[model samples]
Target: MNSKWLWPSIIAVLLIAIWLYLPPGIDPVAVPADSDSIARGEYLVKAGGCISCHEGSEGEGGLSGSAAVESPFGTFYASNITPDPETGIGNWSGEDFIAALRHGRRPDGSFYYPAFPYRAYKGLSEEEILDIAAYLQSQPAISHSVAPHELPAWVGRWQMLGWNLLADWKEPGREMNDDPEIARGEHLVRNLGHCSECHSPRDALGIIQYRDEFKGGEIPDGHVEAIDAEALNSWTEEDLALFFLIGMKQDGEFVGGKMEPVIEHNTSQLTDADREAMAAFFKRGLPASP
Candidate 1:
């Protein structure tokens, strides 16, 4: 190779390497399943809010396709959630499904980006996650690979490893208190519902500000005014569940950013009783603002 061509050739190789190493979206493979398992899987899928994240607003057949989720880091497209063996979760086993939710590890052993909300999901029970997995397996797989996330060159994926260390990831569940009303509400909002993951402000390392609790702030996906600590001090418990169920309140307008999808999927699916308990829990003697 002549010296004049050497630099050009190297540049081409580098580009090729980056392209090849980019994240891939292979739909899960299909497996043989019984009717009972499929029904259980359906319930699990609804509980996990699968459709809200996977399906794009403009996607085909109300299925997950190429919906782009804006984040503090960058934009990430939701992958196809259909059961197409080549493009969806058809091939994933119950164990593989469990690993993704509980451990946040893909079948290939690569870590999933936190954009997937496994941070909140890490608290889920094993049985709960397995049920979700079974439900996903029942869906029809669609063969569509979303575009790879384009992170800035300064911030490599390896940097996420450092963030994870500081995160002190834990399994998804909250300790129950003696009060049935408070505990039921707390469990619904924190574990299965995951409101704080979006509503609460996070520290630089991405841990939720426990002191601030439901006091909301600007999250990665978008800004949420009055969710900050000060606003919650004045609101009643009815305020909290209404916020989740309707995304707005009497005193303020709805700050619907990423939360729109959540209401559409998770909160909307809850029974009226569950929603009320959640409201009661949020209203538990809110601290007076300093």
Candidate 2:
């Protein structure tokens, strides 16, 4: 082997290793009918916050895959994840669903780009993932089919597979602590909250900058959002809670941007206790001034 090629080869090997470990995109579950299963599935859906991405807004048919999500590269439509056999994941099996969520691949065996949030979802447990799939299946299937994302020629669709290899994640689910409050906050943030997905910055390869930890950063699409503990610490816990509830600050400032969808889909739906728990976790983790 020529010494000149060593660096490239090493890089290639590392990238392959990373890709091999990325979570598959969709979690397929056989439709479950047991009451207990449905109940568990419901909780898992709330925990995963699936409705935020799949549902459409006014004028945009609801859950029919017309919701356009704005990203730095371009606007990508949120596809239908419902159980519609014609257009959604309806025909998928539980193993397929698990593979997608834990690994980032579709049932057809294609890689799912990080834009789908499997990066954060990789932490979900198998049991929890099953529940989520069950819950999804239980929802009324929507029949709207959307077009594939149209990327600029410079960025080919297949190129994303290589990118997936570079940024795949395999961390275990959120850890629970003896402190109920702390544990609750951690669950809300790590699982349901998905704060890290947007707040943390991604490298050229699109993997989140874990080293920076929550120090605020740009998204893969170049949109800026503050996740820094210091900046978050500036707000009082109460401020964070109120902001989460209504997407506005205590001072009457409106919170907008990519976060708007999150607030609309998930945060606004959280119970007061969960919001307070999130605030508690943030206040403790974020220092007053970093």
Candidate 3:
């Protein structure tokens, strides 16, 4: 190498540039949740399928996340979220939690890697976000410590900020349709469900192809089947709803793999209305063409 100082100088300049352009400061605010909100939060957490991601491997960790999510960028370890002061998110204020979901940012305003599915979560209502936070507050504290992800050299905070900008990412306005049912369904499917995160393909930079969402793609492990209208045209809404319960198909067979755990921990717990909403969403298909 010509000089080690050359690389250090370049990094220092980049860091300084990023610091100068940092977003405005946001103070952490704590919002205490009532028992009712905590109860509701449990349901929302189940619907969001937090367990599938937060629950560690058989012995690695607990809801204090240790699950590794492998992606094109690199392997990412899910953060410890259980209410443990030192190792988990116990110290985070309710606003901190909300900001994490709304901005893909930490309390300090540092960027969070999108593996947490915050993009899908950004549109969630404040009440919903608070409710989820309340539920997290009630969870038993698990003091599991997870290691940091070793991001590739090219993916710094500024890189992620620019990437989000390219995708037109911004705060959610949360407009709805004339029909409340359809609106509710859309919210569950598009935001809380985050079904497309796994089913849809990502571009080279890891941004989800929203246009082709629900059209299956290869994930870190295996390929998921297309859940788009064209792909599921043969399956009626009724079929889709039933599948959510037990993974049974019209042919009397069952789906296995990653979906099995999803049914057990997430779908089976959802109310009938949410299930129908998801099915209805599938039948209607993407609002825009793939």
- The 10 consecutive residues of candidate 3 with the worst lDDT sum are 166-175
Better of 1 and 2 by lDDT: 2
Evaluate model 2: give its lDDT: 0.70
lDDT of 1 by residue, 36-129 (tens): 6667656545555666777745546545467776666677777766667776666677666666776566767566777677766766766666
Candidate of highest lDDT: 3
Q: Give Cα distance to truth, residue 191, candidate 1, Å.
A: 2.6
lDDT of each residue in 92-125, candidate 2, tens digit only: 7888877777767777766666667776677687
Q: What TM-score against the true fold does each predicted structure earn? A: 0.74, 0.78, 0.86
Q: Which of 1 and 3 is ahead in lDDT?
A: 3
Clashes of 2: 19
Q: Looking at candidate 3, what is the lDDT of residue 212?
A: 80
Error of 2 at 1 (Å): 2.1
**How does candidate 3 score on lDDT?**
0.79
* Higher-TM-score candidate of 1 and 3: 3
Candidate 3: segments with Cα more than 4 A from true spot = 1-29, 59-62, 169-175, 285-290
**Residue 157: error of model 1 in Å?**
3.9
Candidates sorted by lDDT, descending order? 3, 2, 1
